[model samples]
Target: MKLKMHISKIKCINDLTIELPIERGLYAITGQNGSGKSTIVASASRVFFNLPMKEYFGDTVDGAMIEFELDGNKRSWHKKGKSWLQKQTGSMNIRGFYEGSLIYGYRFKDTTYEKLKKSESIDKAKLRPSHEFIRKNLGLILQGDEDYYEKLYEVPREYAKFDSSIFFYEKNGIQVSQFHMSTGENLLLSILNSLYIKNKERKNASKQCIIFLDEIELALHPSSLKRLVAFLEDMARQYDYAIYFSTHSIELISGIKPDNIFYIERYNDGTIGVNNPCYPAYATKFLYDHSGYDNVLLVEDDLAKSIVTRILRKEKLLNSRLVHVLPCGGFRNIIKLADDVTRNNLLGKRASICIIVDKDVKEQAIKYKKENGLASSCGMNFLPIESLEKYLRMSLVYNVDQKLFKRLSDYVFQQRSLQELIAEYRKLKEFDTDKNGKVLYSLLDTELRNRRTDRAELIDLIVEYLFEENKQPIQDIKKFLHKELE
Candidate 1:
């Protein structure tokens, strides 16, 4: 499935379009509160998000246009002066995909649950939101229709561990509804129902459909949100649906692949634009404008985050109340982090964001920067070696044998197994720094394992070596701290 959209003068956005082809996968629209992220989704889904066409008009503007190509067929809606026109028609039924009114045709800003709770009359207030939502989602499947719902068998492995889950039905002698479903669960059921309904939209046509879920993270517990994201991603891959979702949750952005994400923001010129998450300015803006942290160092993961935190502590610069290391999942997030930084710099929001990306992705990082012409405002830096592991490995104190260095190098650098290297280290009675970094993240886990060694203690050993031998990296970090803290 492919969708190319162009909208101009239809809100804060003025002449917005994306040149690259959008393929079937998840597309995230993210930015500050008023960045027109919702407007983009609203325009894509007109049936659910219908607003007065003229109300979206720009100052001194007489016309507004929103056009898009769905499955290579061009369809457009234009408002010229006092008139509106549909330039072309297509077989794709966005309206039909709304399925049935029983599914709750459009999403409501306020939920029925809230309304019922506030009502004074008890007789009219005792309805469950999950009743209609679950029945529509799972009801048809249990009856006979299985083709669509069957895809859910590939549910993420994480769901098996859900101590609490939403149950639609209980057969034989089982009591249910005693276990309450979360708002997140109800919302997930509603979305799945929508997809099942979409399948019914182009029945047996083998047609592609677009599903736009706005601010999908609502009412979601973090764990529930993660499960939902994984489910939706897997669902998109397994089916022909092209998913378009919007979220301000950094967790959601990090959960999905970098290529699948998009960023939207209000520009300096009183217009809003949509851009790739890799845009350097996007991350800058995100950290300064949208997020809660005051001073953040964006790193690759927990291990690197730990190292940075330790280094900051060594320097006595880690103000627990003000500064922290945020591992943005991976190297690709550098761009997203950069985007946040750039926007913050522009808005004068007074945020300090330092990004430390892995060395492996430096080439891809530079290429993206040049391609998008992202201003160098993110204070971006690349690791000297492959990963945080490599740095720690090299920084480890080599004892017992310089003779074992060759043997260690062979096992460590060969991309061999971590368990193999650990075994070699134990047998040789030598301590080699870990460059592969597998141990870095495990060291940061708060819960202690009974059998597991105190890896945090060993980290101090490596860090001591780093402080004594590797002075340059610390100096660089100090610079970042000074800038952010000041």
Candidate 2:
């Protein structure tokens, strides 16, 4: 059975709704920090598992409602409450209604004291949140040593204990009940758990299950993340399970299929807006048409996907409408993807294509470019992940706006690491940090205030300048050759 969720009147969200595919695969929920990404997950947990809404979210006047479909029938839950005065004046009512049937309803007066008085009474609660139930069934793995190597001799119903159980590892060490493990160990354990736990469930279940992971990119090395994605995709197909994970990592976005991709954005009012890449008619067509092409633009791992798409559209070399600007987690994946494209004929006629990789990946980019025929031809363009830095060092150094370019140039010279550069940028007046803490976005008001030229036009001019002075245009070179000779 697939679960669909529609929420209304929740905290920081007025009318937020999203339908999740319960197909046995991964579902990724990603957005800027505090964009209510976690809220969606929390709300779903509350409705599905029958938990106290007040426990997760503090007091609120507006009641929340969730509607979901179960077993081909629609069901809805509504929670209404007034603020309690002195822990005695108000009540919270939970009503479950399904297909004209009033399944259940309960009212709790003075919940604060009631919760404190009977905190151990689990039976009083009508529905347990799905997350809590899963955790309980699976056994809670806390942030320490007890969680690591913790084995369950008996399997919970709807869940089976595997020889290799799900474990959480951190940078410090394996979080065994009380002891911590090394980052490498933690990463290895996470990879193992991600696959092993899912596999075990698939082996035991009569029906397929879905695995949802939040911020899956955390603590994972790029190579490991890539391997995990590939493994997850295969496992989903083999076991008839679906896997969905959210990440701020661009590398994962570009490497995966567009049909499986979903974007979450936050509105000013605190509600989240979901953009499913598969749902968009045009995007769906594009993905279906170009499933194998590897010659792709790989932008910075931390860059906002919207900005990258806008930049590509401005260049006019490729229309963002048709060409997908995939975020390949980072420079490492860019190289990996490019190499894969060249060696594998997955793209057919579109096989030999160029990828815009970061200059920071100089060694790998150059080596790959030299080794492959596709990489040799205008198929590779290495530039710094920072456009300002690239503009300052490469040709047309003076053509760019002096102040903006100089600021980035100075930053590049002063900051030795990308992390340090981003950190310093955040300290500057113009740059603002997004929820993810990884993307440092320039304030549009501040950026435009000092700029005289249209930024998009300036970018195009820069591209034109590079093409004229640095190398021949690939399109022109293609036109000069006659395919009839072949």
Candidate 3:
């Protein structure tokens, strides 16, 4: 059965207490090394591996617990000294790794997914990691659409090797070890073999699966890493599986959907785990300071960061030499992060933090500003409207990046000039008082970013277009920022 809601509470065993939405999708465990990423992995392993609580709590003094929802049932266990006190609210057919569908690990160096790297010769007694995987989930693998079968051709069995305790790739019909393959090729092969095993076993079992991995982006080229992330996300939906992986890759975190990232850290009290930290203050400051920026404006997401950065720089309200844009992920995250990063002179390079959210955030922001004295300290504001996207009020770009270039040209500016298009859209039923001041720009996100369109450049183009067209709302935005900065 798939895990629905899993919560792990711990103390002293790496000082962790975290709740994870360990459902069918990619969940990234991100932090510096030794920040308890592996501990979370171990907690998952303990639950699915049928290991004793004492195994991990061997010396854990403060007590720990694992509670999860599976197959519409709730189960939990807590460590009490060397024994586990188990409790359950419904019936469960508990199964371990051999149950056709269960949690698996690809932790590297010494992992259960592959034969030990130290094994010199193939021992028939122990199943070849891939083959053991093959025998367990062969049915499920074959059931996959053409992609399942396609994997074998891509990682042909003729080139598959286990004699040396590692999988190999076929090059010109020659079986070459993983070392011979390019890093990306090797990663792809490993993933293919693992998926193939699970697919093959899915044919006869009602078991759901979860895969735990760490530092999984190793050796992947940027393009290849992006592709792999897409593939894994898609597969999670197609099959019943959950992937929890750890990484120190900030670039990877930036590229991934913000919601998928969970930043682990050790608090001042020595407790660890980030249940749902939006901006992860420590890591944010760490990354920012390390990058050498002296002033920073923290916003909701990438889009807001881009918008705010462009306006602040254009108005010259922010010192060009020191300011940097940091997206706190969302409004909630911004609030959670504000408490820490807003402190003056934090982390040596911590910038003066300005917080922004939607119009809905005004009350909360104001309250927080007074309670924490952040208003005069740094700066805080909710936009003049509900949301930045809704505030901008561009219908075509409303869902920009949501669907790339789909019927875009057909929908926007068919025969009308820019001013005409704005007038037409403003007259539409959806254009209400809430959408005020946003009807100036054509709704389309820039069609095909020619060069680095992911930054303020895209926002710059839109603002420039409006200024040249004499759009009043564009001027209003500048005035608002000028006042906020003042």
The positional error of residue 203 in candidate 2, measured at the CA in angstroms, is 3.5
Candidate numbers, best TM-score first, in rank order: 3, 1, 2
lDDT leaderboard ranking: 1, 3, 2
In model 3, which range of ten residues has the least summed lDDT?
95-104
User: Candidates' lDDT values, in order?
Assistant: 0.53, 0.44, 0.52
Q: How accurate is candidate 1 locally (lDDT)?
A: 0.53
Better of 1 and 2 by TM-score: 1
| lDDT (tens digit, per residue) of candidate 2 on 93-210 | 1111111001111112122444433332223222222222222322222232333333312122222122222232122542231013444443434333345555666675665355
Local distance difference test, candidate 2: 0.44
Question: What does the lDDT read for residue 21 in candidate 1?
Answer: 29
Expressed as tens digits, the lDDT of each residue in 1-486 for candidate 3 is 245434345533343445555457776777766577666665666555664555443555435676766667777777676667778888543332211111223313234334334332333233223453332222232233323322222222323243213553233555444544455444444566667667667667565566766565666655555655666677777775676666665545555555567787667676665745344443443544434555566677555665667677777877645676677655555654655554544535544556677665677667765675543555566543345445355434354332312332333324433344545666766667534333333242332222223434444444444345545545666775665455
RMSD to the true structure for each prediction, in A, is 14.0, 22.0, 10.6
- Best lDDT among the predictions, by candidate number: 1
Superior by TM-score: candidate 2 or candidate 3: 3
- Assess candidate 2 and give its TM-score to the true structure: 0.39
What candidate 3 gets wrong by more than 4 Å, as runs, is: 1-19, 31-35, 51-57, 61-63, 85-192, 203-207, 217-227, 264-266, 270-285, 288-296, 302-326, 330-353, 370-377, 387-476, 480-486
